[model samples]
Target: MQQLSWLPTHPDLSGAIGQAKRIEDPLQRLHEAVKLAAHQRDFTLTARLDKLAAAGIEQHAAAARLTPLRVALLSSHTVDHLLPAIRVAGLQRRLALSLHVAPYGMYRQALLADDPALNAFAPQLVVLALDAHDAPLQLPLQASQAEVDAAVAERVDELRLLWRRARERYAAQVVQQTLVPVAPPLFGSYEALVPASPRAVIERLNAAIRAAAREDGVLLLDLAWQAAAYGDGLAEPVRWHQAKQLVSPTLAPLYGEHLARIAAATAGLSRKCLVLDLDNTLWGGVIGDDGIDGIQLGQGSPS
Candidate 1:
């Protein structure tokens, strides 16, 4: 596999992971496994950790290491695949997460009607994620700027109402996901010039969402920014067509990691300190082993 460049390395990581799993004590096993999992970023490893953490929590062992956080995931599309990964990612930061996901297309119903189950779960953090397909304008290719503005604003206002309701009713922290730009370009480069194209309306809608979120003190998951790096592969057209999965299940681990961070932040568990290694981080290669000149740094060097 592919390596996640951002996370640092761990020597004999597989061996360490295997050893951690054999600890017998479910609580201790999960604690050790989470520490090892943080030293590397492998989806396979992430999946294993997810399983371990779930088992540990289910066993009802000593939970001193786990910080409890109840989360409400209100989304327009299917997000069941991302739950395990989100739980494990939260465990990496010592968070024990419990999720309340709105059923099917019933997210608005759950929030607006204040569904009894959601009210009982009492989420401390609420995430609102909508897919590109959920909100679309019925306007023409050459509609006026005013027409586009009004349509986009109406969608933003609807979301704003939901955010305010969640905060007021539950006193929960709210996070909004920027809709992924999965809609393909219709007019190629000329698409940007069209005032009322689907892409144009979505772009304007996302802009309005950012402004609304800021004004309402809503934290943003910024899925649009994350989707920009993965291109069409991130959304996976096949899964979207067959299962209505806005994000591919293959990317559940990565998606969960990001979502968990936002959830953790709401709980005041966001990383406050980062300690870096001098050898590989400050200068590429080992300075002591390779000597000073062999290290990559400064002009024409890679660090």
Candidate 2:
């Protein structure tokens, strides 16, 4: 685990407190002082500062308890815009922030797994950024904004109600973490190994693999469905047609992106060791008969 010194504070509260401290009114000064002390970096303060700050909030500042929080940020695009505000709040409240990039669907699956350590982080809030062009609808910007705002307001209200219900069921011991779904992956990979099919043996093997994956937790992204959608009667014969269809210029980039996503997801999980059948794969000539120099590695000989 990595450690960084910062705390999370409410931006609204922090700003209000800062403004309040500048006012001449005794009541306001006291309010602001309490706010400041509540969000202060260090616990140690002189009796004079504590008394002055505490009296304003109508409560003893020292008696206030602060909980350490962990926040995880999941997003596809750069979240640089929110970093400044998040950082300010973090510094004020002493929080730990972990940021990750992944497709929204994948993150949703991960959250549903329900790990206690994940819940303890307790991401209570989320900041989502979306581009209109990427998710275009028939409506114009003004209309879309109104629609989006209403949708978000409704979601917030629904979440509050859900939280209340969850608290009631679990009591104070239940820890709640927020899962915010963002835009889907712009690029992802789906793969299937179809044997020389219509050949009953090969088709059965393919079906079995698909079935097993479905039974397990793995998502079996059916390439056959994709082929049916994209290929114009071009994917029927798996050995010849599907292979040829894959090399088509229109499908190359899509295929490449899918393969890249799968590779990225499984990266660092295990080592891939390639064992070459050296007789045909590495050198052209038979190693038993040919001396090292006689072997057809780089030379023009068609061994």
Candidate 3:
């Protein structure tokens, strides 16, 4: 299933865009367009906004309130497909992002080696997106809890070191993407009790990661929990087996949105503010027409 384009562009978006384009000031026109696009989650909308926002930023970045942010994505899997969505999502929050993607499978090496190119970029935020299959822990299916505990500790310890390096080496905020638990249950309901089971170890690693992240003041992408929330929409087994794309191309846009939200928070530009209309929302009917006494209020009205 195509997750990215799950829904077509809204039928009314074109009319809305036409109205926005009619505005005399370019920045104001772009502002209105962004306001409309920010509330939508569609591939077509993202693509258009990606281009439009880029040009708008180039012309009136400061006036448009486009906050410039430098981001680095160090991943063990393919992530190029997700960039457009990330940029568009940033624009939604009025952030103008500049990104650096580490060489494939070279996430650790780049940071460890202090690659010249990466150092040149000097990213303000670093995202570590390691895949579960890439973890070095190798436990027998029947291995003991002690063995599982040691492996989980070692993996998270290495991650802690990496997080520390990111902060000390570059003064960058770190966002660790939790290892996705893609392994199928080996013993059905009994799997949780078996630490050596592939799924169990991943879960253990995720828990350890969260604890360490909290202690180290590192932010978490928490893919393990995201997968639980996204269900089958997070990824497909076929894509993983065939192309090593840990994230499904169909859901790449949503994935980008998730990452962008983290970036926004780090920049203090997170989407926390909300505006709402009161009609039929805080009450059962329009407050203006019905008035306070006439509107539904905990059995106070029509009773």
Candidate 4:
């Protein structure tokens, strides 16, 4: 285990990752990797450790009991940060996930063109995490509503072409994320004043994307709703400007959970029950000693 950041905050993370890496048993290694992945806030390190464990699983595939899910990740921005999140989600869902990341900014080429390398790395699922900047609908501050609408229509056609080519050439299901609205819009507060602003254009583009995904049988991941679930921290303007990050680093765990649930559902591996610990969870204190009156379980009390 290599320690790089605050140890007090992530005491067991490094150790767990190391232990998982050294373990010979594939299932045990993956279990430990999942725990380690959930604890670390450093996404880059998380991706490294998760990939290490996945490599081991591949090497020992004959002995591994769970079927491995070969997934290709296609994104417009720096998404090495999301690799571990997806792996952790797969672990939680009892699906072994092996990620193959397409070259940065080459998703269109990988999808539309008959790339031999992409075809050879045949995946079971292809995840496309797109952004407003990746699409053609991003308009200048002075653009009119007519221009924005026209651009949106063209973007939809581009998406359709990409999806059509992917399905025809690859044996994989497309999992695409709808475009997230651009923050700190070029038009500022007035951006929402009319339907022609950058914000409105992105919103309309997202809706069109969702509708197209539904009609085409693509697995849609609602990143917009996921951002809302994580609140304002999910989409900080500074992070976007600095690293082109779609969301805050702290929200990775929740993101992993959502992705895991979606993958589990798609694979028909839904959990029967969600186990939760007691004590601080079910009540304020131990249920044994705390009488019925001592326990705080009412409409007002959170317990």
lDDT of 3 by residue, 1-303 (tens): 344343345557656766666667767766875676555555665665665555466677688877888999999878887787888777777787898999988988888776898899999999999888888588888889998999899989888888888888799999999998777789899999887888888888889999999999999988888786566645567887777788865676788778888988888886565777666665677778878777775554322
Candidate 2 local Cα displacement, residue 178, angstroms: 17
lDDT of 2 by residue, 1-303 (tens): 111122234455445555665676655565445444334232122122333443333232223332223233333223333333333222223222233323432333334345354356454332222211122223322344345444444444433453343334323121222221122332233111212111222223334434443443233324433443434322223422333222233333232223222322322222266888787457787777886777777555445
Q: Positional deviation of 140 in candidate 3, in angstroms?
A: 0.9
> Best-fitting candidate, measured by lDDT?
1
Give the total clashing residue pairs for model 1. Answer: 0
* Cα TM-score per model: 0.84, 0.22, 0.82, 0.73
Candidate 2: global Cα-lDDT? 0.34
lDDT of each model, Cα atoms only? Answer: 0.80, 0.34, 0.79, 0.70
Supply candidate 1's per-residue lDDT for 54.
64
**Of models 1 and 4, which has the larger TM-score?**
1
- lDDT (Cα, tens digit) per residue for candidate 1, span 1-303: 233446778887777777777788887877776786576555567767776666677555246456788899998888887787788778777788899998887778888995999999998998887888888778887789999999888888899899988988899999898988777889899887888877878888889999999999999989888776555446677888888888776677678878888877877888887788779877899888999889888654456
* Candidate 1 lDDT for residue 147: 92
Worst 10 residues of 2 by lDDT: 190-199
Q: Runs in model 2 with CA error above 4 Å? A: 1-67, 80-85, 93-122, 138-303
